[model samples]
Structure formats: structure tokens, C-alpha cells
Target: MSEKALVHIIEDDAFLSKALSRLLGAAGYRTLVYGTANDFLTQLATLESGCILLDMNLPGINGMELHAQLRMQANRMPLIYLTGEGSIALSVQAIKNGAEDFLTKPVQKDALLNAIAHAFDQFQIDDLQHHRQQELKRRLGSLTVREKEVFDLLILGLLNKQIAYQLGNAERTVKAHRHSVMEKMCANSLAELVLMATELGLLDKTS
Candidate 1:
């Protein structure tokens, strides 16, 4: 788990929010408490990476509505729903909508901690993937226009001679461009280059 990972607690009940914060704090987890969905949205742009503990019933925008808004904005924060009135239908809907967990209030200590741990684990996985994607994008941006063209054709199973014929270049020039693509992409093999192309969604674009 990341040391800087925070848990955002958005609950209308001040007493419950404080109690939950204390519990999480005692367990060595950092928490930020918000009294309403609007309060949370105010800091949405600047919020740190972590999970959310959202109350089902809020003063203004309810939890489900807030969740929908986050989804629309493409926010991928892990969220756990806390409801005083447990409804199976609501729980099912939350899970289907990508909530990490749904728990009834006065949530069990073990259950809450476990859910938070799992959420943090998920956050780490997502954070790692996001970093890898950015790095791959950076590498791809380093390629010249001609090298990029060669990379695309090479991943599509084109031989050097075929790529040269398509681009009206000498076979040796195409081979040079292919070598540069392989080196710039830091791919050890043709299979690795294809995998990188897949990660960059180049295969989808070509298909």
C-alpha cells in the first residue's frame, strides 16, 4: 500500500464521520472527511489518489448520483458504499456500477479494514498501469514519422520488403527504420514490439 494513499469519507453524519476517521487513523490509514457530496466535488481536481467511503444518503447529492457523476467524468477512484439501511437491490446496483464494496453502518471493524485494504490494493494496481501507459506514450512519441510508419506495418506482420514496396522505399532503408523502431520502443523481440503496439491500441486502429 502507498504511504500517501488517503481515504475520503463523505458522510452527512458528523459523529459517524469522525468515528470512522478515528478508526481508520488508528489503523494507520489517512482520511479526509466531507459532510456532503458538494464538499467533495469542490476538491475533486486536487484530491490525492485513494479510495472513497461514500454514504448512501447525503444532504444534497446522494451517493449513487455522485458515483454516476464520477463515472461520467472518467474518474477511476475505488469507492465503498456505506448505508444505514441495507438494500440488496442498491448493493447489487452499486457493484454493477463498479463500486468496490457496500457495507451496512455500524460496519464491522474487520470488514471495513478489509474493504479498505482491498481498495488500496486496487488503487496501486491502477496507478502502476497508468504510469506504464504514460511511459509507453512517451516512448511512442519519440519515434520519427517514418519510424512510426514502419512500426505500424511491422506489427501488422509486414516483411521489410513488403513495407518498402508499400512506402516506395529501398528494402535496406525500411530495415533501418525497423531497427530504429525496435530500439526506440526498447523491445527485445518482434513479439515484444507487437505487444507494445497492442498496449498502445495500434492494432485496434489498424483492424
Candidate 2:
């Protein structure tokens, strides 16, 4: 979270772009301006990070068109759309097109900041979940075959003694395997272990 998240603005009007840059800058946000949707698209590959603030009406490619292209191409950044046409229909249409917020021209500083803060909160949430998923995969990788088998059974409400009987192993061996599973999965308790497995989509809900 540095000022590195460039809020790319796509507006043909140079004056509005300049005003928006100044406004966003005053609000402690890093800003960038694009004269057209094509310009933004061209620079997108060079941008490894940041969100987009798009103007609905543009010269070459429109904001809605750009939003559609980005969504189709699996662009991950949040998009906030701005427009002079403050019609309810257009606003609803913008939301349908995957715009995070629909704003009219002469943007209010508070409203703009609020929308951006919400978008960034979502961004942070997504970032955290992505990292957590990666960590889950890493932890799952750390589990041994035996431990994974024991984990599968343990989540099914099977106790150590039952698991031992099913696996044709000694009770102590089953306990050791279960303990190792818990440790490798970073689970503090059996219930927590089950929940972890459920979150990882390991649980068959139909069953």
C-alpha cells in the first residue's frame, strides 16, 4: 500500500483529466491520465499493478467498451466509471458492465473517495484471500501420503481408534499419523482441522 497504485483515468477531455488528477492527488492517491481507451489499453501491459478510473464517454473506445474488454481478458483491477450523463439507466448499465462505481461529472470529492475506498477494500480482501489460498496449497504440499490419508479420514468424524482399525495399523501409529496431519496442516484442534478441510473444498457437501 504505497502511492504506487496508479489510478488510471481514461478521459478525452484534457481539462477534466487534469482536474481529476489534482483531486485524487489531494486525497493521497497516485494518479495517471489517458487520453483514450486505446491509450489505456496500450499502457496496460506495462502496468503490473493499480486500479482504473474510467470515463464513460471517450473519443475512440468508450469506457463501457474498455470495461467489457478488460473483463473479457480477465483484467483483475477494480474499475470505477465516471460520466457526465447522470441517468439512472446508464448508472445501472455501468454496474452491469462490471464498473465498481458509477459517478456523474463534477465529481464530489467525498463520494469519489468513498467509492475508491470501497473498491480498494475489496482489492485488499481479494489480495488476502489469494495469498491464503496459495499458503493452503503450500501446506497441503507439505503433507505426506500417509498424513493426507489420515487427514481425509479424520475430517469424517473418525477417531484415532477407528482410523487405526480401518487402516490396519496400530492405535499408536494412527495417533502419530493424525498428530502429524494436524501439525502439517497447521490445525490446532480436530474441529479446526475439519473446518480447514471444508474451506479448502475437500468436504463433499452432498454426502
Candidate 3:
């Protein structure tokens, strides 16, 4: 099976666009070309996973402007610039503005493939970290107001009797709620649960 990745080429030159598209397609990469910045933006909302190959110079809304637009929209898609010779300043600017890398035209097949691979590797790492943050938030949200209180106390090394006294609840009531808290948190051990609570800044105190 061909493990091809989708690549979006934002180039206006018909000859270069067709040639580049053919080169990438031959290398087992699914390719799409947009002739203008506006065209790319129109379809940006519908895109899921694809790295952008942008041209530095364009007729309306040039490459740098497009780069800023993507940032303003809070879209973190990987960008690789395709610029002409003597455009080092523009290439530097692209890197500062969050481009993964830029390729000078006429682009080399090996360099282009390597840049695409590197961009996707970074994209995967970013996706993983983003999901991990979401999961931590979900787990923390599982705690009830009262459960949070008991959890904080438990982390402080408070016995059930002390926790009951502190919260003005019976020792048996504290025990029941503690069990419920552990189950909701999916913590296998008291120490492990305490560590999770501490990492989340939910532990009121530690012994």
C-alpha cells in the first residue's frame, strides 16, 4: 500500500504548479494546488491534515500576509515556503513566523520530501500534547466540590478520623466518599492518586 500524505501547494505559476504536483505525486504524495492565497483560505475551514507549500511572491495577498492570516485564525498547520533565489530575507521572515522550512525553486525532490516528513513528525507531536492536555482536564473535571476537599485532605496525610473532624463529617461518610473519589479518578493506589492530585495542583497540602 502507498502511504501517501496530502500536500497543499499554494503556487500561482501553472508550469511550476503542474511540474511540482507531478513530482510529488510520483513520489507517493497526494497533492492539491491553489493558485492564490484567497483560494487557499476559502478551503482552509474544510481542511483536516495537510502541510502547505506556499510561494513567497503572489499577485494578491502575498505569502507573508497569508502566513499572518493563518496565525490570526489560530490555525497551527505546518508551512513550507517555495521562494525564488535572492529571497533569503523573506525565507528568514517565514521561519520567524512559524514555517517549518522553505525550499528555493526549482525545488529538489529529495529536499521537498524530507521537509514534508519533518513537518508531519512535528504535527504528530503537537497533536499528542494537545490531546494529553485535554485528557488531564477531563480527568480533573470528574471531581465533585466535596470530593475535591476530601482529596486535598487525603494528600495531606490526614487519617479518616482527622478528615471527618476537619470536614465536620462522620468517619464512615469520609471513607465512602474517598472510595468514590478514587473510583472516579481511576487511581489504582492512594499514593498514585495523591501524585496525580499534586501534579494537577489540586492537593491542598502534602506531608
Candidate number achieving the greatest TM-score relative to the actual structure: 1
Q: Provide TM-scores for the models.
A: 0.90, 0.79, 0.73
lDDT of 3 by residue, 1-207 (tens): 126878899999989999989988987889889999999999988975688999988879998899999999978778998888537787777789999997898778889889988998898888777776566668768888888789878878889999999999999999998998888878888998877766666655444
The TM-score, computed over Cα atoms with residue i paired to residue i, of candidate 3 is: 0.73
Clashing pairs in 3: none
lDDT of 1 at 190: 96
Instruction: Tell me which residue pairs clash in candidate 1.
Output: none
Model 1 stretches with alpha carbons more than 4 Å out: none
Choose 2 or 3, whichever is better by TM-score.
2
> Which candidate wins on lDDT?
1
lDDT of 2 at 115: 91
> lDDT value for candidate 1?
0.93
Off by over 4 Å in 3: 85-93, 148-182, 189-207
Q: Which ten-residue region of model 3 has the weakest summed lDDT? A: 198-207
Candidate 1, residues 63-152, lDDT tens digits: the string is 999999999998989999999987999999999999999999989999999999998888788878888889999999999999999988
**What lDDT does each candidate get?**
0.93, 0.84, 0.84
